[model samples]
Target: MKADGEALVFYENGERVGTVPLAPLSRVFMRGDVTVSSSLLGKLGERGIGVVVLSGRKAVPTMLLGRPHNDAARRVAQYRLSLDPDFCLRFSRAIVEAKLRAQAAFLGERRESEPRSRYLLTLSLKRLSSSITAVDQQATIASLRGVEGAGAAAYFEGFADLLPERLHFCGRNRRPPRDPVNAVLSLGYTLLHAETVLALYGSGPTPSSASIMRSTSHANRWPVTWSSHCGWRSTSMH
Candidate 1:
């Protein structure tokens, strides 16, 4: 990749392949054997554009934030708030409840369209509804996580029913993702995770340094790794 006046030009085997305008673009995602010139990177940084590199067969993401915010206090507050146990519990509960509700709603919608699949979808929706109630009643973050996990299992079971017969997807699988459907799902999740991290950084918080429902030891170690590699403070919890 190289800067060509107002556009970023892409090359393959010494031949020009494409050009993307710098204006109206906030970020760029590069994957697999892509070479970016220092001049183009500098230009992108000057224009406040973030760049994310997704590498390897699994598409692991590494993000480059445009510039650090001037407000140090906001980041400090975010760090402190993340350490509060009560706050973490409440935040986790809310996130889980919202996610489960959305899953139930999606299943409900699919049930309307696929009446033959109604039995499985309805069962999943009921499980999600129960999980939402359990999330609200939970006192500890660990129990809340358990509820979320159960709800996710039920939700994915129904999701498999929605896939076309050609896909042959029976359940969710990851890490290596044996089937094409699972591979696509894994890629989609990786992209979403990258986007979420970017959004968190843009909203004045470090993603690798904060923990919401994650174990304390893991949260503490993640920030160190992120900071070491990315030259930015890490905050993470999920």
Candidate 2:
């Protein structure tokens, strides 16, 4: 890719294929060995556009942040909030509750449509509802994670029932997703994470400030997927 004044031009086999205007762009995600010209990088940086590079089979991410937001006060407030355990617990609890409720609702819909899976879906719905009730009672992130984990297992129990037999999608798995269902889910999550990072940066607070759980490492990390909420996946990318 090369910068052409106000736009970026794309080439395939030495032939120009397309051009994209830079004016309306906020972020660019590049995967594998794609070549980007220095002039384009300069232009992107000048326009305060973020770039995310993904490499290797694991698709590890390297983020190139754009010019910082001017909302210093908001950023400072978010960082301070992140330090408060009580606040983080409350936020994390709310997130978990919302996720559980949504899962239950989805299962309820499927229960009606899939008579063969109704028994499994009913079991999941009951478990999810119980977890939602238990969310506020949990005082620590670790305990909260346990509740969420149980709920997720129940949720996926029903989820697996809804899938066609040929899919063989018994449960969620990743880190080189073993099955076709998991592979597609992983790809969707990776893309969602990139979009979420862009949205967070485009707003005010840094992605690190959005973290609800404490990391063992001193460095603050942002989750690469909503999988963290499911309690079965890694909380942050390495």
Candidate 3:
């Protein structure tokens, strides 16, 4: 958790209990009640080090989460997750199914049989689908270039506007920490994009891709928060 980058910490009941990787490890395993402060965790994550939070039994990793992500495979996986042509088709079918269920839910009341709700739902679904496709396209076309990194960013514009207003919405109320749908998509794909970016951060001879990665990560922890992908935070710059 220290900037030492040489330290691997584990805590027991808030007490710093031990360390590991006798050598400087590129990875760290935070197990049990091992206590490391969030600052250390953020530093580790910033360095692109992998952090694995374990479950109670130690055998089951209840949270196999990524810190700042360091994989390139996620790019390809995201394309699949981005909802291609098949996704559009399936989404449409889901709308129809939802509408039918909606009608059935109201059958006992013998109401006016309004299709407005269904129509709005379907329309919202289409718009949401379009937004998703746009984000996917952006991710697909993006390269390591400064300008290019954001070429695909536009596809996910105005993401803050889409979320279920009825639910608790993650303790945000009128102004939620983040919209559920947007939060899922942002956290999911950004992790993939960041991993790809991190792997290229300092692994090259020429400054081309690596320099761009450094600049991007420094300017903004895009992998962490795409909202400011161009941020120039000194901490994440490295």
lDDT of every model, 2 decimals: 0.73, 0.76, 0.36
Ranking by TM-score: 1, 2, 3
| Superposed Cα RMSD, model 2 | 4.1
- For candidate 3, the C-alpha RMSD (Å) to the true structure equals 14.6
Q: Give one digit per residue, the lDDT tens place, for model 1 in 1-238.
A: 9999999999889999999899988889988888889999988888778898988987877887776556778889877977887877776676666677777777888899998899989888888888878887888877876897898889888888888878878887887797778888777665666666666666667766643435655345343232222211111101
Candidate 3 residue 173 C-alpha distance from true site, Å: 16
| lDDT (10s digit) by residue, model 3, range 89-110 | 3433333233323322332122
Model with the higher TM-score, candidate 1 or 3: 1
Give the poorly placed runs of model 1, Cα more than 4 Å off. 216-238
Clashes of 1: 9
Residue 20's lDDT within candidate 3 is 62
lDDT-superior candidate, 1 or 2: 2
The per-prediction tally of clashing pairs is 9, 0, 8
TM-score of each: 0.87, 0.87, 0.27
